[model samples]
Target: MVTSEKNIQMIMELADAFGPSGFEDDVLTVARKWAEGLGTIEEDHMRNLYIHRKENTGNKPVIMLDAHSDEVGFMIHSIKPNGTLRFVTLGRFANIAMSSADVLVRNALGEYIPGVIAAKPVHFMSESERAKGGVPEISSMVIDIGATSAEEAVNRFHIRIGEPGVPATKCRYDAENDVMFGKGFDCRIGCAAVIETLRRLEGMDLPCDVIGVLSSQEEVGERGCKVSVKHANPSIAFVFEGCPADDTFTEPYAIQTALKKGPMLRFMDVSVICSPRYQRYVLDLASEKGIAAQASVREGGGNNGAIINTALDGTPVVVAGVPTRYIHSMNCITSGYDFEETVKLAVATVTSMTPEQIAKF
Candidate 1:
């Protein structure tokens, strides 16, 4: 069977999970189920999930494979007298894209109640209010779940302050177009890649020990990776991410990340300058193996790669990403081709690595 068919369903489930930064329980649940028997599974208080490959020999150098298990979302800050919810963003979001967006609020009862990011209707806006261009700050916005008053929201809906919420979008695959539409692809796509890579390497005898980490709370400043890096101190690392695709809006010549082109190997983003030697090696390996891959120098954005790279006096790290369009929003799109290529590249990298080669990095 094709690799895509084997793992795409798990990818969809990861994308649909209700995890947002500090609240990564649901995401870990899905990951653990898919990773069962792949290795020894372990989790920390911070909810970081680690799978130590059964083939590992403690004497060998560790190869850390990472993918965060959180998505951009919101947290309820307060309940207004009108029963609307005032909230704060758990991670960054384009405020303009938030108005009237569908959301699922996790009330105190652990129930995800349906709601919308309420926006002021055009007809209700005064002339001066309308004069202000663009959307209001997210702090001023509220989520409405149809409660008549604060008491009703508290008693009937069981809504409480500090609850988490996520975009209310379902994941769907377009087989004809080879595209996927969903939320939380930012790192969920990466999570699937890490799992599939481990599965492919199950019986292989490599020179290095492999540890796959589905880290948590990445969107809130790479908190989970900071912890997992200490646990899996390795000589090298690969961070799989669902990176923002630039093809649709960027100038043709300036575009480095594009869908269906392949997985992107970024030299550097705002966070870290990746180990140049290792990055070049991976790129060269991709060329030699005929795996579809792209390279980019991002002006903005960051990932767990930055954290792992600097940890333990530095480790050579590369960020391989699926070109996901509309990341950090309610909906995102990625190609099935990109995902497959990523898995192949990851497998090749592991199989080709040796103690001598890692020492060179």
Candidate 2:
């Protein structure tokens, strides 16, 4: 089973998990469940999850496969007297697309309460507001959960001052098109790839020991990989991401990341330049193995790879990203074909990597 039914289920579950920056318990819950038999799982105080392969010999160099578990979301800042919740952005949400969107707020009781990001309706807007004709500031919006007063909001709804919330979009797959629609594809899809890659390499005897890290709080910054990298101390790393696709808006010749093309192998983004020799090696290997892959030179955007590349004596790292459209917004689209190719490319990479190749890089 190349891209098995379980793999698709895992992708949907990971993408559907309600996880925000600094609030990743739900995401880790799903990750651990799917990764049950793959390795010995351990988590940190900051909720960085590590999966140590059971076949590791402890004598070989460590290889780290990393994907963050957090997504762009909102955090409750204060509740107005009218029972409306004011919020602050967590990570980089597409604020322009946020008004009137459905969200699930995590209340103090650890339950998700449904809400809508409400803004003043057109009838209530002043002439100036209508003439200005621009998107409202996120600060001006409120999350309404049907409570009529602050007392009701707190006492009845259990809403608190610092709860996190994410888009209430569920995952849906189009089997005919091999596409997926959902929220939080920024890194959840990447998380699925890491898990599936580990599963594929389960019984193999490789030149290096591998560890899978479902890191946390990446949308806020590259924070989780800082800890995960130190814990794993890998000599080399493979970072996976659901990168923003440029196909929809970019010029015809400039499109590098497109849905259904393959996983993107980025040489450089805003954060860090990837290991050139290693990137070339993997691209060449993909060609030799006839695996679909895309090469990208991004103008903006970053990932856990930047942190891992500088973590310990500068580990050699490459990022294999699934091309996702409309990331950082409430909803996103990605291709199942891209995901499958990502897993295949990664599996081929680790299986072919050796100590000699590492020395050259």
Best by lDDT: 1
Q: What is the Cα-based lDDT of residue 129 in candidate 2?
A: 88
Clash number for each model = 0, 0
Candidate 2 — what's its lDDT?
0.92
For every model shown, what is its TM-score relative to the native structure? 0.98, 0.98
Q: Please write out the lDDT profile of model 1 over residues 1-361, one tens digit for every residue.
A: 1346658799999999999998999999999999998989999999999999999988999999999999999999999999999999988999887998999999988999999999788788888778886477888889999999999999999999999999999999988888899999999999999999999999889999999999999999999999999998888999999999999999999999999988999999999998999999999999999999999999999999999988787899999999999999998999788999999999999998998998898
TM-score (C-alpha, index-matched) for candidate 2: 0.98
Global lDDT scores for all candidate models: 0.93, 0.92
